[model samples]
Target: MENHDAAALLEQAAQLDAGDPLARYRGLFIGTDTALSYLDGNSLGRPLKRTQRDISTFIGEGWGGWLIRGWDEEWLDLPQTIGDQLGRAVLGAAPGQTVIADSTTVVLYKLIRAALATVSDPARTEIVLDTDNFPTDRYLVEGIAREEGLTLRWIEADPASGVTVEQVRHATGPATAVVLLSHVAYRSGFLADLPGITEVAHSAGALVVWDLCHSAGSVELDLDGANVDFAAGCTYKYLNGGPGSPAFAYVNRRHLSGLKQPIWGWMGRKDAFEMAAGYEPAPGIRSFLSGTPAIFGMLAMRGTLDLIEEAGMAAIREKSLKLTAFAVQLFEAWLEPAGVELASPRDPELRGSHITLDHPAFRNVTAALWEQDVIPDFRAPHGIRVGLSPLSTSFAELFRGMAAIRDQLRR
Candidate 1:
């Protein structure tokens, strides 16, 4: 709030940026050279320099040259091949369990249906869900329950925090067929306990489906270790995939054969080209595919996944913690005094790679901030979500963005 305080914080940011081992990665992005303080990487990540070259190469050598033979050669299995890479680099899943296909909503729908189908008991007719989940997750479940004559058991979650293991335990019972939840809260950046929740759901004889939009690349996941039933996420965020990139779905290998997702398509048949009479699902993860792969959308994320593999998820998570922590420090020193309230968790362990700050004035302040080239997304009811992507976001960039927020709040 004061000049001296601002000066001190600026110096601290400079020191952190200077010492940041991941700092060099900022150069790989397209728009980092400008004065823009891109504080929205949690929403959509910046494109990589390699993405352009990769797309070009695909056009020239892979798609442009190979023609439709591309399907026979590689495109037929592109989803699983890249899905395997994504699993190895980010999802903590083994091969044959993850597939890249469809929009996140479509994938979520398929997985949720599949999970519900696995429950044969006539008494298990309710779906357990949370209040604070993303709109799509809630909407999809609501529609599915309506169509299937299933009841919805809602978990009331605090916007400041997230669903606790205790809440999940209380929410599940004999009636619960499946429990759907977000690994990280979309509004608050609160990280949920995956293993604990999954264990609880299993005890209740319910399958678990995790929404990983905010969890995929920001946090280290152990879907296999947790014995998770199903998971899906968008690649556009910390995974740095371009806009509208295909989402990925992970089904526990144990469920590969028995689980039958509701949607069926020609591509998912045992032999896609067979044009067979009755549909026999493809073996393993490939059965999840409902249509042709989005070759262009998948290209950008490959570069980021390569970077994630090279840097390792552990180091990325460590940097993420530091980045979010540093953003909290700035929020306290500058924004809090300007009447900005921290909407996310105070404890780093409970948080993800981003934090939200709320103020009555933020709705309009967001427009002013964006005009100044300090772009953080505005959530409903006056919340500014500051998403810090560890690879492309610098401490100094965060400081600049926070300073701009403080200035706008003051204005």
Candidate 2:
């Protein structure tokens, strides 16, 4: 019976991979040919094979040859250039409103502060957010509230799901300045209703800022249609830009006028070459810039963004849904019998590109799984996140990883 079950799963994975439209893309990444099962792409994606060649070329030409002149020739506009591409491809945004720079934390801080600055009503002194948001988001809001003498309105969220529109409506009021949220919950892989939540916040006379870390490439984002006020997310995960890659920020075009990001540096000056005294901010999204852009960090994602634009977000989202559904299928068939609880949403529409499983033994099982080359990430309190990146991950890899998890659990 066990052998038959294994054969059935292998057949299911093969059929899924055979019918997959994006399956052709699996081999484009760094190690698709290997037996290494990487189920943690939502935490850190596999690097693109082309990134190596691009880096080699940039080192010999842009850095080695152009030197300081590279700033004048290309580096100055690199942030907005890449930002425009990212906006068009993955963010569902138009040009000139998005800029790529800074860490996601810094970008979130700048946008949150900017949102607060735009509020004219003195009574609107409270920043509303959920308890289950990423730590950086909650921490920034807490510190900012302290700094500006504001109040925090908390929305109690479930670890099994995420923030909902009804919860936002209940938590927000006349005193709410802005609502901070994550588009996709990191732990449970729950995708929040971005447009509905934004509408709720707007109805309460509040702007919305979203953390897009888990949804940028894994799910389809229509930021413009959602009427999002501000947003930030890292590139290292689904964007495949390597570790510590520069993050991107978006501001609605209407908000760009008289908008000032808190961080002001010489590079953000209207005429950075002027070198003259008082810091006059640059025009448009360029003003969001604080210091020199990390050219090296930005290089890898350009290739990935090109791939995203080529494959299109709709197709990517389709494959992501399939991957996670396959994951849940195997989880129920194998891990559920072993006392592993599915920590993520069961519905495909409500889920992001990943899923989590909870078992008391997972606290130690994760390290063991890693030693055997079956890679998934561990969250706090014995939750193992199975992050399936659609572009870089294949159904076969997912099956292998799931089988390994079951084997580990049985021991």
The global C-alpha lDDT for each of the candidates, from Candidate 1 onward, is: 0.92, 0.93
Off by over 4 Å in 1: none
Best by lDDT: 2
At residue 245, give the lDDT of candidate 2: 95
Quick one: RMSD of model 1?
1.0
Q: Which run of 10 residues does model 1 get worst, by summed lDDT?
A: 331-340
On TM-score, the candidate that comes out on top is 2
Q: Give the total clashing residue pairs for model 2.
A: 0
Model 1 CA lDDT for position 94: 87
Q: How do the residues 1-411 of candidate 1 rate in per-residue lDDT, one tens digit apiece?
A: 588988998999989989888888889999998889999999999999999898999999998999999889888888999999999999999888888998899999999999988888999999999999999999999999999999999999999899999999999999989999999999999999999999999999999999999989989999999999999999999988888999999999999989798888888889888787998999888888877788888889989999999888998899999999999999898888777899999999999999999999999999999999999999999899999999999998999999899888887
TM-score of each: 0.98, 0.99
Query: Where's the lowest-lDDT run of ten residues in candidate 2?
Result: 258-267
- Candidate 2: clashing pairs of residues: none
lDDT of 2: 0.93
- Candidate 2: where are CA atoms >4 Å away? none
